[model samples]
Target: MLKLNKIFIFTGCLLVILSIELLLAQKQTKTYRNYHFVYDTADSVYVKKLAAKIKKQLHQIEFFFNYKPKSIITIIITRSDAEYTSYRGKIMPEWSQALALTREKIILLKIENADDIIRSPEILLHELVHIFFDDRITTHKIPVWLHEGIAQYLSGYELTVNDRIHLANALTSNNIISLTAMDSLFTFGQVKARLAYIEALTAIQFIVKNHGVAALQMLINN
Candidate 1:
């Protein structure tokens, strides 16, 4: 009887050890090594790269605001055009924007996922300007034009005669949406309309570059 009892106890201990080993193996399998990421599968490298860039940019912005920014901004990056159009169109009726962070530390997915474009720091910086000033503004009365134009301008996207002609055509042809009504002009059709968008972004670029992002903070405050 004593021998049988000892055998039973030893068998039970072995089983428990095996179970723990299995659980540890499972836990190890579940762990993901990459940091600053939520998505599975590596289809888009640009998303990963841009996320790092955005983090670096935020350090400068926090200094600009003179506040210790405490927030974990999460961005879900998607490459599907249909997904892009649906999200962007639903929010503000446009789809070509590269980056946007709403008032709540929630940035809508950056849409420009093209490898070449995503690599451009200027485009991300343009959106960062909006993120910085938008968060600083307590009230929500600023014209939509301010955000969009500032984004376009600071992004370093150029404007020329060809873009002007396209925008003029959009306006004269009535293809462009009403300037007063366009809450955010991310997806204007005519080339000229886009040029106008570039111009708006540049205005932001100008303000920050010359007057300062602080000026934008004041603009939003007032």
Candidate 2:
């Protein structure tokens, strides 16, 4: 009789715990402007701010792409590196702060703390640029380098001083990489990935400088 009572108490506690977890999980989701954002209850304010920023960025992306993606987008915000890695699985690089699965229209972002919130806008915009390009351009013939270049360029990602230094060193050493070599940039480790991104950004900048934005747009349209 005493043993039965103990077992029942343990089972009741277990059920209560599961119910609480389910409620918490349900509270994490919020929808805004066709975007479904998921984050912890503690991040409610952060998610609201992010959703507002996304709405503004969406206009910027539409202006650049000349089209808006009509599909619903999902943004998952992870609070730690471990959570981000777990959500992304093996396909994510250790250095990646965010990832956009364009096919699925999902963006996964890792935010360490409140301090990291400032970086979220650019990261979110960058991923949205990828999604916009993928949706606007139906052809699979677009090169990976060009795809990433467009995303970085449209997201307002400029080359930093460190990127300039890397480019200078690569140029001086005659070790500059071709666009084709950058096709697998994300697969490479951190150092190589950074260089590849800088190179791709510069490539798009060069095109814009030499041929102008119209030329770039024409190429994209074709």
Candidate 3:
């Protein structure tokens, strides 16, 4: 029975790999300016509609950073949750909707439904910020709070009133997490993670409010 179970597991894994390969083979490519989008053939119409918006957002980001990436940015938009999880032979966190592979100049987005498709531009802008910021500085490792904070800020993630309430409540209750602990917050439960994001955004907001935009660029430089 143990041997049979092992066989079953192996076969399942093999099938998953084959399925992903088939999906990749069936992917359609669409190029818009510096961006190259790779998505399932069925998503072609959606991707085509999204490309112009993505281009506009990319230009805004480039202007904000005053830097343009020389290499093409490859974006892979996965059509379903299963394909999204199975691609690259690695499973991402369930809460993660998108990711930026900084060095590889690639962004992977999971589009599970119409809402996700509508939100794709915002998601893409966030990941693009990550890539662009990483491209600016090569030597030092950016702190998680600062990294996430900057990305959120540049991508125009506004803090809701509830977010402010949650943050204030945490602060008053002495449940506030340290900046050092922010790195591990992503692996924690959703409630904590949400708080962490709020904290990070607030931190960046404070910095920008007091120090000015030049301070952010200086921080990126050194």
Top-scoring candidate (TM-score): 3
Query: Candidate 1: deviation at residue 50, Å?
Result: 2.4
lDDT of each: 0.51, 0.78, 0.80
Global CA lDDT computed for model 3: 0.80
Per-model root-mean-square deviation over C-alphas: 17.0, 11.3, 6.4
Candidate order by decreasing lDDT = 3, 2, 1
lDDT of 1 by residue, 109-181 (tens): 4444466345455555565566666666656666777756655544455666776676667668776554465
TM-score of 3: 0.83
lDDT of 2 by residue, 152-177 (tens): 88777789898999999989998787
Whole-model alpha-carbon lDDT for candidate 1: 0.51
Q: Which segments of candidate 3 are over 4 A away from where they belong?
A: 1-22, 88-91
The candidate with the higher TM-score, 1 or 2, is 2
Ranking by TM-score: 3, 2, 1
TM-score of 1: 0.55
After TM-score superposition, what is the CA distance of residue 25 in candidate 3 from its true location, in Å? 1.6
- Residue 217 CA displacement from its true place in model 3, Å: 0.9
| Residue 142, model 1, lDDT | 68
Model 2 off-target regions past 4 Å?
1-27
**1 against 2, candidate with superior lDDT:** 2
